[model samples]
Target: MQLSSLRAIGISKSFGAVAVLDRVDLAVHPGETYALLGPSGCGKSTLLRVMAGFETADEGRVELAGRVVRRPSPERGMVAQAGTLFPWLSLRDNLAFGPRESGRGDTEEIVAGLLEATGLTEFADALPRQLSGGMRQRAAIAQVLANAPPVLLLDEPFGALDAQTRLRMHEWLRSVLAARETTTLLVTHDVDEALLLADRLGLLSARPARLVEEIPVPFGGARGRHTLSDPAFVRMKAQILDRVMVA
Candidate 1:
């Protein structure tokens, strides 16, 4: 068996007397997108946070490429629902910030490539306030990628976008991940989104969440708008919905 790029081994967490996660175990393979799907407030984000080292697990450990994750590292970059770009910085500067801060010499090349990759080259001089929600989100993700993280933690990064824009982003993101082969762990309550993006889906129960089922998505790669209507996709969506309804 190949080693997992990111692994959550028997993770559990609680606040006060309320347990949020209950012995959750997950393994995301190299360059594969794995999503944790569940109802709202079901501890999906908590698990992602623990894996990102933003929050420590009470009972277990998180490992990234065989090293125990001790604290937040640029290697495990996280993009949350809200835009994370600096409000005052242009999109170009935002992408360059990480590399420059880390003292890398190729900031210009990295920034230019990210701008092109995210289709934000035109908006490179624009501030976050000047961009649409979707564009800002794209820039947020681009900023993270500029850091060259092997693992990307997405905490409902598209939850705030409108339906149409979100759909478009789904397609764009699929292509980006395919090209970069970034190992991703996404947390979302949207079943369709999870089904559309992930190589495998892990269903989580309500509070004190547990991994109830793991389903492989057979859609292969490069999903588009048509994917939402595909028979297999519809069936899998329905199946996952049914599981979530009962979870």
Candidate 2:
């Protein structure tokens, strides 16, 4: 499978006279996940918003699968930190909304499977208010998957959860993405989260952000940051942490 280019070339974004990002370039190949890690005000979320088309880049371009994704199209979907679901809608209804809106031939069965996969089937009829934080977030992600987006832009998707829940969600996300191998770009401030979930990690400098470093996570039996017990993993984490804190 030739995973297409999900590239951000010399991307820059500004709000009026204040700039958030400058000349930041990101390239995530098909089936690979890249975590964008930086401290607060470093433009991680801003970059994600631009990639999701919620904010337009002031300069540079975004290209997907050889074509420029001009605006917020369903080909791309976002999972926000808040899991911004419709409070009044039931989980099943929320999943139905996207496919139904797109006229994509009734995704009922697909939605059912996704709900089950995300462990939300029992809560399908529950409103967002009735679900736990993790469940609601899972539903939000499932809702996006219903549309079958080729690329997923996750902006601190699990940042709001408790530490235990956040780690569990990372484990769950790995299982979910395994089947599809969907290209993903996740923006996160937590170093451990990035190390655990990403195939590669990119570090950025503070506001008027620029790419500073890229690290490829090793694939092995090491689970959690406990994997840092390995000498190589320990060195990698220390190196990335040093760059992050110093930046």
Consecutive 10-residue window with the lowest summed lDDT within model 1: 1-10
lDDT of 2 by residue, 1-247 (tens): 3455598989998888888999999999898888999878889998988888888898998999978876897777899999968888989989988999988775788788888898888888988999989888888988888888889899999888999898888888877777778889999988777777789999999888999988888854235645537677677778888898877
Assess each prediction's global lDDT (C-alpha) against the native: 0.91, 0.85
Off by over 4 Å in 2: 220-231
Best TM-score goes to which candidate? 1
Which lDDT tens digits does candidate 1 get at residues 2-85? 224999999999999999999999999999999999988899999998999989899999998888986998898899999789
For lDDT, the strongest prediction is 1
RMSD of each candidate relative to the true structure = 1.9, 1.8
